[model samples]
Target: MIESHNTKGLIFNVQYYSIHDGPGIRTTVFMKGCPLKCLWCQNPESQRLQREIFFELEKCTGCGICVQACSEGAIELFEGRSRTNRKKCSGTGRCAEVCPVEARKIMGRSVTAKEVFEEVARDALFYQRSGGGVTLSGGEPLAQPRFAVSVLKLCKDAGIHTTVDTCGYASWDTVQQVLSYADLVLYDFKHIDPAEHKRYTGVSNELILDNARKIYHELAIPMLARVPIIPTYNDSADNIKATTQFISSELGKNIKVHLLPYHRLGETKYERLEKMDLAVLIEPPAEEQMLALQEIVQSFGLEAVLGG
Candidate 1:
């Protein structure tokens, strides 16, 4: 039992009433920081551990309020547009505070486990009625093991079903810590091939696959394999077949596979975070393509569902 409710962790969002994350309407707590740098990451702002500024160019009116608010002089008008010198800016959120149109915003916040749990518990009535609970999502929940454990433990103590959504890139010990409290695990299976996985997510799938096996065979936890069907990446029939076969042979046939179709929803987030949208040109998988992949997954005698 985690006795400390004061352990601080960085989190970006607390989304309530989310149906896709777990069994029912869930409140997904998006933790800050991630080890994997996937090309098609939906939460680019969640990549960094510390608080960062989000400057929406279209929302800025070039009124120079943020310029005067920033003590570091990080903000300067460049042709009637506010530009930030990220190196000079310390993410103090002073500029974001004074932005009239809400163009400038800070991405993440530091909060205690108790504080987060209190907010999560606010939606207990909704969770009870819908058979939903709280989900710990990324950046990668296991990246901050202690904080994740604290939050999960708090939810579990309160009788809220806990789920950990992870990339399966963390250590076995970290996975064990989270699993101690998590009722379910949503593990991301990016690609079957390690080389391709590394090429895309900047990490090998060797540890991920190994962790999946450990979690399934050793821990015997309720697990769901979530595969994001990218158009030109991991959507091929060969990769899909390999993924299903691995689950059937290594992990068990009872595990359900969620076939998630990749979308450009996070593309605009890159603009706000001042990062490049690497997969901007990539289109979402067609409906027919997703259905075909579902067929391949079901062919392995595994239940496959489209979207979370």
Candidate 2:
């Protein structure tokens, strides 16, 4: 069992009043680090396990405040723009703290489970009123098994409904440990074909599929499968049908399948993080396409809903 008192987790964001994650008016805690490198990933900053500096070139005025604040000499002004030497930057966030403009920002933070629990508990009234509670999301929450379990346990102990939004790629033991405290599981089923899955997400779907099957058969917890409909990726009719069929046969028809449409919301994030946006040219699935996929899921006797 994981201890909750002093366990610390690296979290990238804690989104409150989220209606799309799980149930009504929930808080989604975005943990740092992930095993898969999905091409259409929205949160690029969440991929790394440590704190990162996000520099917006347009917002930077080359004031040298960040340059002066950075004791490690990680920042330099070149042609009226502040550049960051990521390797030299210690992720101390001092440069961000001293920056006048909001150009410099830190991406992740380490917080105790107790601190997270307290913050989440603040919305207890809202959760109780709306049948919503707390959701542990990623950069696969299962990647930080102990911290995820700690936070979930604390929330569950306080009579708050807890949900784990995971990629379902972890070992069965890790999945079992975290799910023991989760009220619901928002599992991501990217692609049914293992090679295609690896081609797009940088990982095979074998372990993810196996873990999902085990979670359904071994655990009594309710699960909702989420699929991101990325263009030229896993948005094909064949992939959708195969995914829905697997969900219906292996995971049971009662499970709801959410077809999430891909968006370019994270395009700017890639620019800030200086990472390649592979899906930059890929457009979101059209409404008609989403509806068609939903129909396909319904054909397998499974409930399919567009968006979270």
Candidate 3:
């Protein structure tokens, strides 16, 4: 793919000085949009392509300020409780703009590549000092391939290291476009079996597995396959062994894998986003369980990391 000089991406967050995402202290750019609907997704807010409203019940004063501010009458106060009619709401952010307590927040915004690069450049000194740069994360950065590549190009021009944290579900062409600018890739490996993968993530694993191989072999991109260990979903010894075998034998190596233990940090977001029905909240595995899984990877003669 050719470089797009002025592509715009829908971004939700620009987190600075992060040590976990890449090689060193780095900034993580959270872009919006993803193909898979993983049951245990941590960033529920980043799943959609368009901007979304987050309603916090505790912060709401029930003053009806947002109700009046909403031109579409999407917000209403009932029994001193504020509710949003998601169907009526157009995500214009007008209600959020008028909310007194920030109870209503619009999550995503359209940002030009140049603008995003400027924000990342503010941390250039830290990147140089810590051998860290910028990490493109998301709902799957490859979902917005053009915008992703554009920002990556800016990072390349600035001599900053780039890492792409992806689900590896996009087309091979799209992967090639963005991989051109990425120095390291963080690939999410949810399940080895296609049936189990589709059961939890709502998509076939064929595309994802195929893309992983293309990244490692065909494209020759260095990538770390990370797994989110969900209890009863993918934490079994058999699952772990299967994943390690695939990473070690099929996927090109360094044979490095990161085990991301599931946590309930984003559980409340389900209610805020009114998506509890879609969420599969479960207790995280014990530290010992994680350690055991790590050892399983090591048993395969592959380097295993506890966290990403």
Each prediction's whole-model lDDT (CA) = 0.91, 0.90, 0.89
Residue pairs in steric clash, candidate 3? none
- Ten residues in sequence with the least summed lDDT for candidate 3: 1-10
Against the hidden true structure, what lDDT does model 3 obtain? 0.89
By TM-score, how accurate is candidate 1? Answer: 0.96
Cα error, candidate 1, residue 216 (Å): 1.0
Q: How does residue 161 of candidate 3 score in lDDT?
A: 96
lDDT of 1 by residue, 1-308 (tens): 35379989999999998999989999999999999998888888888788899888998889998999999988899989898887888889998899999998898999999999999999999989989999999899988889999999999999999999999998888888778889999999999999999999999999999999999888888999899998787899999999999999999999899999998888888888776635355798999999999999999999999998
Task: Count residue pairs with overlapping backbones in model 2.
Answer: 0
* Residue 257 of model 1, lDDT score: 96
Candidate achieving the largest lDDT:
1
Give per-model TM-scores: 0.96, 0.96, 0.97
- Indicate whether candidate 2 or candidate 3 has the larger lDDT: 2
Which segments of candidate 3 are over 4 A away from where they belong?
A: none
Q: Which residue segments of model 2 deviate by more than 4 Å?
A: 276-279
**Candidate 2 lDDT over residue span 82-152, tens digit each:** 99887898899998899898898999989999999999999999999999999999898988999998898
How many clashing pairs per prediction, in order?
A: 0, 0, 0
lDDT for 100 in candidate 2 is: 90
